[model samples]
Target chain A: MEAALTAGIGTPLSRSAADALNSVDLTALTPGTPAFVGAVERVLTSFFTTRREIVDPLGPVFVDAAEALAQFVVRGGKRTRPGFAWTGWLGAGGDPAGPDAAAVLTACSALELVQACALVHDDIIDSSRTRRGFPTVHIDFEDRHRAAHWPGDGAAYGSAVAILIGDLALAWADDLVHEAGLDPAALARFAPVWARMRTEVLGGQLLDINGEAGGDESVEAALRINRYKTAAYTIERPLHLGAALAGADDDLVAALRVYGTDVGIAFQLRDDLLGVFGDPAVTGKPSGDDLREGKRTVLIAEGLRRADPESAALIRTGLGTDLSDADVDRLRTVLKDLGAVDDVEGRIRDLTHSGLNAIAVSTTTGPAKKLLYDMALAATRRTA
Target chain B: MEAALTAGIGTPLSRSAADALNSVDLTALTPGTPAFVGAVERVLTSFFTTRREIVDPLGPVFVDAAEALAQFVVRGGKRTRPGFAWTGWLGAGGDPAGPDAAAVLTACSALELVQACALVHDDIIDSSRTRRGFPTVHIDFEDRHRAAHWPGDGAAYGSAVAILIGDLALAWADDLVHEAGLDPAALARFAPVWARMRTEVLGGQLLDINGEAGGDESVEAALRINRYKTAAYTIERPLHLGAALAGADDDLVAALRVYGTDVGIAFQLRDDLLGVFGDPAVTGKPSGDDLREGKRTVLIAEGLRRADPESAALIRTGLGTDLSDADVDRLRTVLKDLGAVDDVEGRIRDLTHSGLNAIAVSTTTGPAKKLLYDMALAATRRTA
Candidate 1:
C-alpha cells in the first residue's frame, strides 16, 4: 500500500498508448476543428482505458459499468462542447503546439465526461429507455438484473447503479482536469469556469424538473431553463473555460460568450425541433420523444401560447403522453398551421444570425473566426 | 452577463460573515478535536450562504432546493470525516495558526459536503424514507410534489430532483476545495487522494448493490464491501487527503492508513450492530432497517454461515423481509444464539486495539496520537 502510494496510483496514459489511440497525423490538419475532435476523443479513450484498469480489480460487475461508461464516452455524441472549447482556445490565440497544449487538450476532453454524467442521470430522470439507439445505462443495468434474476426490483437496481455510474463519471471528470498538468496560475483561472458550469447545468436540471411539476407553459420559462441547462453548460462555459485555460483577455472571453449563448440557445431550439420531427434513424431517439417526455421547450411553449382554444387543447393533450405516430403528426400539423413551427424557426434564424454577428465583430484570430461562423450554422442546422 | 463575469461570481466567504458564523474563539480550544468540527461547520455555513446567493436569481424553486441542501449540509451528521481529516493534518504536523490555516480548514470542511452528497444519493438508492429523523431529500421532494399536485409520478419527480441536488452538492464540494487557496504543489498532491476517495466510495457503493443483488452472503464479500464502502471513504481517504494536503511523508501516511482501515472497519461493524438492535430514536432510523434493506453485513453473513438448517431458514426468511417486532426479536435471538453478535463484538475490540497499537508505534506528533486513540474507541463503541 505504501509503495503504491509512493509510486502514485492510476498512472496517466502512456505515450505509446496515446499514440496508438490517436494515429491521426494531427499536425497535417487544421488545429482546433476537425483535428481537435480527434484529439479530444483520443484523450477520452486513454482516460477511460486507465480508469477501466483501476476498476478492473473491483471485479467484473464494476468493470461492466465502467466499460459501459467508456464506450458511451468514446463512441457517443458529436463532441460539440470540446469543439467549441478548442475553437475558443484558438480564437484566444492558444497555440496547439504550445507547452500547455497537452494540458489544455486534456481539460477540454474532460467536458465529454461531464456530458456523459449529465446524460446518464438525465436518462434516469426521464426514465429514458434508449440513447443513440442503445439502451440507456439504467436500462442496461436493469436488463442485466432481470437476466440474472437478481433479488430486487430490476428497475430500482438499474437506476441505483446508473446513479453511481453517473457519479463516477462526474468524479473522474474533475480528476482528468486535476491531472491535466496545468500550471497553478492557469488552473486558478480555469476553476471558476468549471465550478460555474457544473452549477448551472445541475441547477438548470432542477429548474427543468421544477417547471414540469409546476406545469409552467410560458416561453420565457422554457428559454430560461434552456439558458442555464443547455446554453451555459453546452456552449458558453465550455468556450469560456477554454479561453480561461489559454489565459485569454476579458474582452475575448466575453465576446466568445456572447456568441456561445446565442448559438447554444439556437442549437437547443434545433434539438427541440428534432426531438419532435426528425427521423428517429438520424436522431437515434424515438420520434416525438420531447413530446412523450413532456419536455418544456421553447417550441412547445410558443405553440401553446399561439394556438387557438381547440388547437391548444390538441397540443396539450398530445404532450407528455404516450403518443402514436398519428397523434404526433396531428400535433405537428397543428403547430405548423398555428405558425408555431415557423415562429421557432424564425427565432433559430435570428439567434444564429445574432451569434454570427457577434463573431463578425470580435477580434478573433486566424481560422478560428471562420470556424466559429461555420460552427454556428452547423450546430443549428444539424439533423441529430 | 459581461459585467457579472468581470466582477467575479460566487464570492468567497467574507471575513465579517465568517466571524459572525464562527464566533467561537477557535484559538482557545484544541485545534483538531471538538474545535475542528465547529470550524468546519462555520466554513460550511459561509459557503452555503454564498452558494444560496448564486442560486437565488435562478428563482425560488431553485433556491428552495439549494436551501434544502444547505440545511442538510449545515445541520446534519456528526462531522466524523472532517474530524479525522483535521486530525490527519495535525498528525502530519500542520500548523494550526499557519498562513495556510484558513485554506486547510476550508478544504477539510468540504468533506462534509461530500458526505452530504453520498448520503443524499444513498437515500434515493436505498429508497429510505428518513435520515437523521428528517425526511430524506427525495422524500421531501416527493412530498413537495404531492403537496403542489404536481403532474407526474411524485416519487420519480422526487428522485430526479434529489439526484440533481446531490450532483450539485458534489460539484460544490470540488468548488470549495478548489477555492480553498491551496498552492500548486499542495493541490497537486491533494488531487489524487480526492480522486481515489471518490472512486473507492462510488465503486464500493456499486460493489455493495452488486453484492446484495447477487446474494453474496459470504463474510469475505461482506467485509470487502465494508472495506471500500464505509471504511475507506469515511476514514482512510479523509485522513490520506488531509495528510496529502499537508505534504506528509509516505511513512506517516501509510501508518495512518493502517490505523484508519482497522478503525473504519470496526466503526462499520458497530454500525451493523446498531442498525439492528439499537434504539430507533437514537439511530434516527426504524428498528431493523438494515434487515429490511437486506444489507449483507458481516454479522448477518456469519449468522447464516453458523446457524443450523432450520435456524438458517429462519435467518434467510427474516433477512430481507418486512418484519414485525416479534419477527425482528426472533431474528435477533437467532443471531445471538448463533454467536454472530459475540463474534462481531470481539472483532470490533481486537480491531480497535490493533488500531490503537498502530497509533502508539507511529511518529504522529502532538496531541493527535491521543485523540486518535480516543476516536478509535468512540467510533467503534458508539451505539449509533
Candidate 2:
C-alpha cells in the first residue's frame, strides 16, 4: 500500500533527494516538517503564555479561554497546507537556507491557525462532536458548562465559546503574519492572495454547508464546491502565497495553480472515499461521517448519477441520516455496485498524474519538484 | 443638557475646527467625521463587494453569506472606535494634512471590523435578540432558515452562520490593514497593540459571560471586566494604534491610555445606566437589552452592593430572566432607589473630567486635543 512511486524516478538522487526517494509519506520524511509544525506549536504555546500574562491581570477565567484555543491549535492538524506553502516557496527559487526563510516559515505557520478556525467552526456547523478523534471544541465547552452547572443552555454556551475561540484564531492568524516582519513590498504583493485564500475558504465552506442542505446533486456542481473549499485553501492558495513570498512571476504562479488544483481535487476525492469506506483507525474519524453529514461530495454525486431510481432514493436517505453501522455497510455496497467508487478512484489517478506533470514541466528545482510530486501521492493515497 | 464645553480657548475655530467645536455629539460632527465614518462604511461595503466577486464565482449561496456580513458592517455601528483612532493620530502631532493621513484613516478603519466581530459574537454570548435596532445575525439567519423550509434546527444553522461571519470580520480586519500599504516600521510598531486589543477584548468578553453566570457581582470585578472589554479595545487601543501610526512617543501613548481608560469606563457605565433608562428610539436597541441579558456592569454591581436583601434578591432575579416590562420597570426602581444610578452618574462625571485632563497634559495638537475632549463627552453622555 505504501506505493513509493520514487521507485520509478529516472534520475539519481542526492541526500535531500533521497528522503523524497525514500518515502511517499508527507508526515514522516520531510525534514523540519515536524520541526515546522513544532515551531508553530511552540508559538501557539507562547501566544497563550503571553495572553495569560495579560489576562492574569484580568482573571483566571480569561486565561481559561486563551488556553483552550492554544490547546486546540497546538494539538491537532497535519500542517499539510503549510507544508505546501513552504515547498511552493522553495520551488519558486526562494532560498530555504536564508534568513527570510524563517519569516516565510512563520507566514506558512499562519495557515495552521486558519485551519484551526475552519475545523472548530466546521464542527459546530456540522454538529460534529469529535475531531482528530477527540471531543470537538464546542462539545468540550458544552461539557465544561454542564460540569460547572452554569445557567442557560449548555449547547448555546458551548456554541458561544466556540464562536469566540474561532474568532480569536482568525485574529491570531493575522497577528502571526504581521509579527513575522516580512518585507513590506513582499507583504503588499502577498495581501491579495492571502485575502483571497481567507475569503475563498469561507465561501467554499458556505457552499459546502448549503450543499449539505440539498442544493445540487450533479458531479459538476459537487466538484465546483470541492474546488473552492478544498483545492483553493488547502493547496493552490497556499502554494500561491509561498510563490508570492519567493517573488514568483505570474507564469510560475500560474503553473503552481495548475499543479495545486488538480492535486487538491484528487486529495479531497480520497478524503471522501475514506469518509465512507476507509477504516476509522486509519482515518481518525468515525466510519461513515460523510454519509451521516450527507456530504454532497463528487463521489456521492456520481453514485446518485448511476443508481436506479429506488436505489438513488435510498442513497439520498443516507445523506444526513443516523443509520446503523450495518445500514451504512449496505449503502456502501450500493455505491460500489453503481460504479461510483471505481469512477472516483480512476479520476483521482488521472488528476494526480496531471498534478505531478504540472510540477515537472515548471522550472522548479529538482528536489522541490520531487517533494511536491511525493506530496501529491502521499496526500491522495493516504489511509489516514 | 448639551453642556457645550468649548471652555475659554483663545483662538477662533477654523471651519473644520468650528464643526469640531460646534457639537460635542460624536455621531454628528467634524469634517471627516460623518465623512470619515462614511469612508469606512464604504470601505466595508467594498470589502464584501470584492468578497462577493470572489464568492459569486463560487456559488450564489456563498454570495448570500458575504452580502449578509457586508450589510451588517455597513448598516450598523457608530464607527466610534475608528473615530477615536483617527483622532488619536491627529492628536499625536501627526499632520492631518499629510499624504500618509489616508493610510492612518485606513488603519483606523480596521477597528470597526474588530468591533463588528465583537458585537456579533457578544450578542450570541448574551443571547441578545436584537442589536442596532434589528434582529441579531443569528436570529436573522434562524428566521431565514425557518422561512426557507430548511431541515434541521434553524437556531443551530443561524448560530453557525453568525459564527462564520464574525470570524470573517476578524480576518478581514487584518486584511484591511495590510492592504493599506502602511510603512513597515509603523506597522511593526502598531502590531503589538492591535494583537493586544483583539485578545483582551476576547478575555474581557469571557469575563462578562462568566460573570453573568453568577461568578462575580462586585463593582471592582465589573469595572475590571469593563476595562478589558469596553475600555481597552474601545478607546485606549484605538488611540494607541493611532498614536503608533503617528510615531508618537511612549509618553504620548501612555497619556492617551489614561484618557481612554477613564473615558472608556465612563462610556460603558453610561451604557449600563441607559440599558434600563434610555429611550429605545435614541439608543437604537430594544429598551433594556443589557438588563435582559443580565450584563454584569458596574452599575449593576453598585445596585447589588447597596440594595436591601429584598431589593438585592429582586435584582438577582432580574439577572438572565425573561422579565416582563413590568418586572424590568420594578428592577429599574431597585437600581434607582439604591442610588446606584446616581453613583454611576457621579463616576461618569469624575471619569470624563479625568479623561479630559489626561488629554490636556499630553503633547497633542490643540484641535485634535479638543476633538478628544469632545469625544469623551460625546461617548459617555450620549443617550444611546
Which candidate has the highest DockQ of all? Answer: 1
Model 2 Cα shift for residue A318 (angstroms):
3.3
Model 1 clashing residue pairs (backbone): none
lDDT of 2 by residue, A89-119 (tens): 8889877656576667667777888898899
Candidate 1 lDDT (Cα, 0 to 1): 0.81
Tell me the whole-model lDDT of each prediction, alpha carbons only. Answer: 0.81, 0.76
Q: What is chain B's TM-score across the candidates, in the order shown?
A: 0.90, 0.86
Q: What does candidate 1's lDDT look like per residue over A1-384, in tens digits?
A: 345344443323232223322345433434345566677778888777766545765667678888888888887867888877877887888887666666777788788999999999999998889888899999999999999877768998999999999999998899888877778888888887888788888888888888877757799889979888988888888888888888787777778887888889999999999998999999878888888877778998899899889988888877889999899888888888878889889989998888787778887886889888878877899898
Off by over 4 Å in 1: A1-35, A52-54, A277-289, A322-329, B1-35, B279-289, B324-326
lDDT string, candidate 2, B1-384, tens digits: 001111211011111101121222233325335666666665566555545435566777777777787788889757888888878887887665565665666677778788888888887776779877789998998898888888878887787778777877887788777655478777877777787788889878877777766577899989988888899888988888888888887667777888888899999998888888889999766777778877788988999899889988888877767888888888888888899999999999998887788778879888888788778878888887
Model 2 segments beyond 4 Å from truth?
Answer: A1-36, A284-287, B1-33, B279-290, B322-330
Q: Residue A129, candidate 1: how far off, in angstroms?
A: 1.0
Query: Judged by TM-score, which candidate is best?
Result: 1
